[model samples]
Target chain A: MRMPSPKQTLAKAEMDMTPMIDMTFQLIAFFMVLLNFAETEQDARIKLPSSELAKPPEVALESPLVLQLTKDDKVIFGGELLPISGLGQPLSREKRFLELNGVDPKEATIVIRADGDAKTGVVQEVMQLCQENDFEIFALRAKQELAEEEP
Target chain B: MKLRNTGELSDKVDIQMTPMIDIVFLLLIFFIFNFRIVVQEGDFNIRMPVAGPSAASIDTQLPIRVRLTSDDEGNLTGIVAGDRKLDNFSDLHQFILAQVGNDAGPDGADNMEVELDCDYGLKYRYVISAVTAISGYVTADGHIVKLIQKIKLSPPKKPS
Candidate 1:
């Protein structure tokens, strides 16, 4: 049986959007927890060297220490310039503190982000310091793309 | 067929969009603040050849040493593998594979360890190319396998 259309139904159209809005909020929350801002700690002034053989480490360090080497021969640690020769004292202190806090110094990783033009010797000094402090793992940061070489 | 508006109803209830738009804007701002732009800086896990003078040394086997030398301008001048001067990255990869052999070790260990001694001045591009070449190989079945699983970095020699 064909019945007459209701006047209220023809006057307005309304749709529920609560489900979609809930999904959007969930996505936002997911990214907020996953994004690790500390990982992008490269100094803008330092141009990283590139390597084709360089692959991302299998496991990432939770609290890997960062050190930067500039072309001017300055070793920047935590934004303060430190002498290449004097890096040992602080490094040892860091290791000692890590030990006190129950973190094994041997398990801790140190990442070195150095400029290509920086003297190899200066970079080695930092590596040597890390080695002397009983730290085993070290990561040398390099850009993966060959086309992105800094002019 | 022409129809008449016989069932018209009041449509005066306007939905408020101001609060919904404000919430969306707030969510967008939150994402922008928390998002970290990852600079694809490949972390080449180059462990030191010698784990300092602390741990007792293991006499497993001698690693194939590939020395990379650079000029004062940080230009990669030479790539040498025990007296063989390789011109390109492919040669470096081939040379290392030739030395390691096609068959895996009896213990299923790739056993082919390479220690790279790279110049600090040498751009990372060269190092990575050489590393990429020597580390993995394409099998006859078209499968890729890493030839040299273990890689160690030799400390840079001081520039004279």
Candidate 2:
């Protein structure tokens, strides 16, 4: 048998790190693109009702006003919690703001995020209040219900 | 010490990669920690002008009324579509499908509207289910065929 070469024994073991670094960079890029920094106006207190027909709108809503209705019938708008009765003043303010900005309150979308457990009456009341403020368009927000797996 | 010639340079310049790899790993970890798998949310749009029935277009016909009633605990008790009583949402969907059919033109569903008349004490989930039934149904292949695009609410009844 031939003896092993001394040069081969003396050489340091090296790993080709190019492939690993390339893969790591690819993963980082993938995450960077998918990262969502936009803060959606969602409140944890309201557990939205789920519906199979509620697909996301193809066209983005223009200047939507998000209102979260808690189970207890309180409305959360612009980070302030108020009773359904007290929503009129804030709604008026909102209408005025829209007028000042030259946007029609009728064109503005009021997105209602009502709790699944909330009373239907309260949701209607909120809608009525929005109508009083001349906010004609309303979007009832619902969680997307995942389809059940077939056997 | 013996001095090497200044004119002679090494064939390969070893660039240190440890710090770069460390920083890259930190970034990956940060993103992984902050990564959130958010459930998708959707909306049901309804145009209800301040002016009650007068807001409706003159050409459009009367809206079909679907009533939802509930018990004291807010549980859904009954569902009525116009004059017919529906046992459940599926029944309501069938009723709507029979009425609307496939007569929708290229512009989508007809100009028909569905008015939701829900009881004050009813849970919102039932109302959503009713809306889901009235709006549309997803085919087996996951395609959504819209039924009625125009939906409005009837005047809310007082909670008993």
Candidate 3:
């Protein structure tokens, strides 16, 4: 008689990937919702002062130009760092660029993001320079501070 | 009827999950690296044209003069609003509130303008605080009661 064939006891182990896929898609969705693409130019060197009344505007500003002021009295415009006095060239360039696009320099809003420790005089000088450049509309940026709840 | 039986199971199609999982993990890593926690920012608008004599004369009501002085280290030393000397920002806020009542209209006192005269060495944060105090205040109902809608900065004084 033929030898008894050895018993075949192989089992296929297939893990259920449905739950993992579901979780991964959910994670992707969560991240997608939280992703901000506003292109807000922020600098790590400047610490903005906080204010309770500083509420984000209801409507977005028209033609905003951001000027970041470092505590050391330097201005960061379009990624180029320059002293307050050196800002004239860049300001004129920006004004010309705006005019080329048919946008009045006065119509553009200059968003000033100055360091909390920066000199108030320097901040004023920056504003004056912008004013001289005919960029009149100014917005001094401040971080939002939440008030404590009253019992 | 006689039938021939072929031993077989159901046909199963195995999808390749390796490439898909690889792509998904890459996307997740991309998003993770791009994630940044940014603080919320707001603005205190100041419309200052080139300071001309005519512009100052145009306004019938005199702007409230706010003077902020500081020491050599840029620490606030004193706050003077008009003729009154204020101890802190809260006093300045109250002074403004008293001057400009909580009214919003074309003829309301909210049209009052504040002219900030900051010392050369004053810390910029104090200027922001002064602006916040004069601009508006948040009420208990979470509504922002705007006081003075106009603000201007005095020409920078000589460094002391």
Candidate 4:
């Protein structure tokens, strides 16, 4: 038996990275396809109130009860203006209504999506209502980049 | 027999990429499922305040949340403590302090927790004023008060 020279040995020791590159490209494509853009746009009109102690919510869960506050202090939920002077009673009533309809109130977190120019009174009114409704988990929606400057 | 040596070589090489492709696909799926893309929108322009490192964790013993709202003129308008509405910030802060001072906890310090809910579009100065007022109430009498420690600032909720 004759042994191959150093040049032949070097040629046989080459590693082919084509498979690895292909796999990487495939993964990138998969992530790009599964991204959800609709949820990203839903809160586009919500300008969250800032705070020194505010932190981005730990986890993003589905089925959040979103409350949109307009500049005129009109509260819109599910594309309809809620007809209540204050947020407390109406929200409690709505949560009860959801529970009556077989929805779990505890599983639903409240997302306060307020217009930047909306009055603070309106926001508080809603928050006060949410508290009465037993909604403890609250998430204030804001741009991710802007959230970094919150604290 | 006449044999000649040639230096020609093919550029293509066959390599098994099934396992590598499978791993890449798995990673791509993981990120795709975990990636959260958030796009925020709202009418209010808010500049949130920052604080130096203070005590960690929320004081949940006497959690009394206060919400402040400003009118179109940027003046403090409404105040809410828990589910009750107060006339103004002064009243709200005084009420909170009174409650905290009365409660007897460990070390004789009040264990009241205060959470502030402010409007997004309200002037930062107004929020600061409210916060200052609340802080003052917590540290009154110069007796080394330590009841209320954590101050949580939250966004105001829209009325439903």
* Regions of model 4 farther than 4 Å from truth: A1-34, A38-41, A50-54, A60-63, A81-108, A131-137, A142-151, B1-72, B75-110, B115-160
Candidate No. with top TM-score? 3
Give lDDT tens digits, candidate 2, residues B80-152: 9989999999999999887786445554355788889988989998888988998998877888888887888
List, for all models, the DockQ compared with the true complex: 0.31, 0.63, 0.79, 0.16
Residue A13, model 3: lDDT of 79
Clashing pairs in 2: none
Question: C-alpha displacement of A115 in model 4, angstroms?
Answer: 2.3
Q: How high is the lDDT of residue B124 in model 1?
A: 53
Candidate 1 chain A weakest lDDT stretch, 10 residues? A142-151
- Model 2, docking class: medium
Best by DockQ: 3
Model 1 misplaced stretches (Cα beyond 4 Å): A1-38, A50-55, A79-83, A143-151, B1-20, B26-42, B49-57, B102-110, B137-144
- Please rank every candidate by lDDT, starting with the best: 3, 2, 1, 4
> For model 3, what is the alpha-carbon lDDT of residue B69?
89
Per-residue lDDT of model 4, residues A1-151, tens digit only: 9888978667456676777686678768766776665564364445544332233445565447778877677777767676446556667776888789877665566776766456656665666566657664555543322212222
> Could you tell me every candidate's TM-score relative to the true structure?
0.69, 0.83, 0.91, 0.41
Error of 4 at B138 (Å): 23
Q: Looking at candidate 3, what is the lDDT of residue B55? A: 59
For each candidate, what is the lDDT?
Answer: 0.71, 0.86, 0.87, 0.58
Residue A15 in candidate 4, Cα distance off native in Å: 30
Proportion of true contacts reproduced by candidate 3: 0.80
- Candidate 1 C-alpha lDDT tens digits along A49-68: 76544556667674587888
